[model samples]
Target chain A: MTDPVVKATALRKCYGDLCAVDGVDFEIGRGECFGLLGPNGAGKTTTVKMLTCALPVTGGDLTVEGLSVKEDPRAIKYLLGVCPQEVNLDPDFSVVKNLVVYSRYYDIPRAEAEKRAAELIARFHLHDKLERPVEDLSGGMKKRLLLARALINRPRLLVLDEPTTGLDPQSRRQIWQEVRDMKKNGLTTLLTTHYIEEAELLCDRLVIMDNGRIIEQGTPRQLIEKHLPGGGNLEDVFLKLTGKHLRDE
Target chain B: MNNSLAGSLSYRAWYMWRRNVDVSLVTWKTNVLPPLLEPVLYILAFGFGLGAYVQQISYAGRAWDYLAFMAPGMVAVGVMFHSVFDTMYGAFVRLRYQKTFDALITTPLSPEDILAGEILSGATKGLFAGAAILLVVTLFGLAQYPSSLLILPLSALAGLLFASFGLYFAALAPYIDNLNLPVFLFINPMFLFSGTFFPLDGLPAWVRLLAELLPLTHLVNITRAATLGLLSPSLGWDLLYLVLLTPAVAWLAIAKMKARLIK
Candidate 1:
């Protein structure tokens, strides 16, 4: 509908002789939730890492907000917030300190960073744990903190790598609600998840990947119709597309 | 924000250090204090106990109190020893076990900034520990000369050099626990052989060369020169050696961090 905010053209990442992300191409429109759906080791995280410019390209190219990762990773980093698959906050730091101190690294003004950190703390319902260390918080609270920290920069594009991993249903739903709210504010999102429910509920369009390649792609409804016999829920569609083979990795 | 590039870097470093003081104090309590106190105790037991028998040991000109002559050397050793542990083992835990750098990397700060800030933090811890030991030694009257005040800044720079060394090594640590071997093997030997406990006068030529090779030897020599008026080498040469080492070690720290983070 609009100029693509993120463009991936034949993007690839190789570890020694192994090409984890092999020649995958996709484009995400502005203000849309584009998902990378795949089984484990499907190069989803690799793609997210490359897009975040945390990892070297190794091959091909990815452009975020029209800035090529190759040409301008630092600028790309400034414009995006990456919520990694793992919750790696400083466990020793308090709930609020983690977010505020992290924002300072982005060269964000301390007063502004603290203000946004407080707002996000309240927004994520972590107002109570403002002075408590992160390790003391439950798993769900940590996930929420990660989400809050990610948004502190008011990132132009938000990249979530398996955001819902290790989260319970209640926390997952809370996250879903928050993401929907983010969508209302018109923040573009790119995420990868093995959970079809997350993809179905959040993603506007997604690509099903396998063995470093895209097997199927489109909106939830479109993919079901095109790739399956019935345009049912995302689970049935995923089961049909990926088949009965268990993804051990 | 509106300063020249260098001013901004030092400002950012200071800001980060100021904010991290609580954590840094905890680090000093756990890591720097024990190693610092160990050297002070070594000076008291070894220096005072041996000073009576070795009354007129010719250090510079007049016979100095063995403890007084040894106090500044202990200060130098304290900065080196505690700073090595602070930057090596302590930083290793942050780098590998805690992955604290990963937390910092997500921010807008560059690796250079992180490197600079961490080194300063380590140096501050070193200086703090050295200062604490100096106070304890002063109470014991081992810090005899007025020139002993100069030891503080010299120890701070020495601590920084070792801190940079430790931070550089931290990037190479696969596990935080692996640092014990290097500390025990490399640094401990330097402490023993680098004229910390005694003078290097009686040692063979090769042994003296070994002592000369260590950065600790130069630091101890500089501090001892100030305290005991022993001018084996001028203050300018000693400062040159230490000042040259700071940027050299910082460059290595930046290079190692770049390799680790920019993957």
Candidate 2:
């Protein structure tokens, strides 16, 4: 698809003998909002970890921004932003310092990094909390700050692992606006989520994976139309995509 | 193209050094102050009360007083212990509870850079504590050997070596219970047996050799040589010992971190 910006072929990840990802092949176009829609334990996070070089690929080949993660993980990481599900901010550092030190880890120039951080903080409506500690912030403020910190490097590809989970409605809407802004700015996103509505609203195209493999792939409208008449709802679509078997995992 | 790991490691070390200084100030109460009180007690207990009874540094080849000879060694020991403790506890907390390394692995920084930066921060903490102890030593007129200035840098190096070892423990520490074993088995034993309080020369030959095998031995020896002005034993060998051990420990730490990161 238009010379994919990210190409993962036969990506296989195993935790010991348990194959978490089994021969999954996928691609994401430049500036495309791609979604990996799945239930829990559906290999979405495992794939994300492999894509971001956070987890070792037992057997596979993957590339991000035309760079091979195997050969150039550091360079690829430089061009990618990851908003993890867990907000692991340094509580000791002030908001500004949190952004500041994080940027330094990427070898981003201090002056430029600080300036960019200030601009992002202002843009994200977090200017007042610049001097505040992380533990003192509201849940929503912390979530937004997490996203801001992720985007501090202005990455080419944004990989979000359940980016919107555990957010209040207002915070979710705020995050949705930021994600939309990222898409409008032509930043490609590879998002993983169990929320069918999030995938429907935000994703341009999607894949529904179960048991470490993509069972179906197409635009959200396409999957809804081809599988369900009238393309009315996603809960029915998800049920049809997956069986009634409860995912205890 | 010269893409040596050191280029990146050094850059990260410098970068992390800057961040840690900022953090050190923010948590100055937690990171810097607790370490401050620790040495004050050690100096008071050993130098004030014990110094009177054991006031003769006969082995130091003069009657300078035990505190005078031990003060520099204590500073070295403080830097070593505190740096190692700071790194292990901070890194273990980050690795286990905070998952900071999990977050950092997603960035452009490699495992080597993370290890280098963390170890550098530990060394910086050591320098801070060592400097504070030096001030106290100066106020009491306890510093006899003028060459002890070199001990500061030597202690910093030794601090890094110990912190590297600490980072290795942290990388492997999978749980809270697993965390305590290393400090108990490895760190405390090194402290007691490193000849921190007593002379190693009088120990059994194998015991002395085991002490020599540890990093603290080289550290305390250098500091003692500096404070007592006893360089006839060769400072170059001491420096060589630290030089050789520093990279090895740092490399092990990096390798362990890299293994852990490839999750």
List, in the given order, the native-contact fraction of each candidate. 0.32, 0.69
Give residue A245's error in model 2 in angstroms.
3.3
- The digit string of per-residue lDDT tens for model 2 on B153-238 reads 77688878888888888778877578689878877777777766666767899988888887777787777777666765576887
Give each model's whole-structure lDDT: 0.78, 0.80
Q: Chain A TM-score, candidate 1? A: 0.96
* TM-score list, all predictions: 0.89, 0.93
Once superposed on the true structure, which residue ranges of model 2 sit more than 4 Å away at CA?
A: A230-232, B1-10, B60-64, B201-209
C-alpha lDDT (0 to 100) for residue A15 of candidate 1: 78
Which pairs in model 2 have colliding backbones?
none
lDDT of 2 by residue, A54-76 (tens): 77678878898778877778788
Candidate 1: where is the Cα deviation over 4 Å?
Answer: A239-249, B1-22, B25-36, B49-56, B144-146, B229-235
Top candidate (DockQ): 2
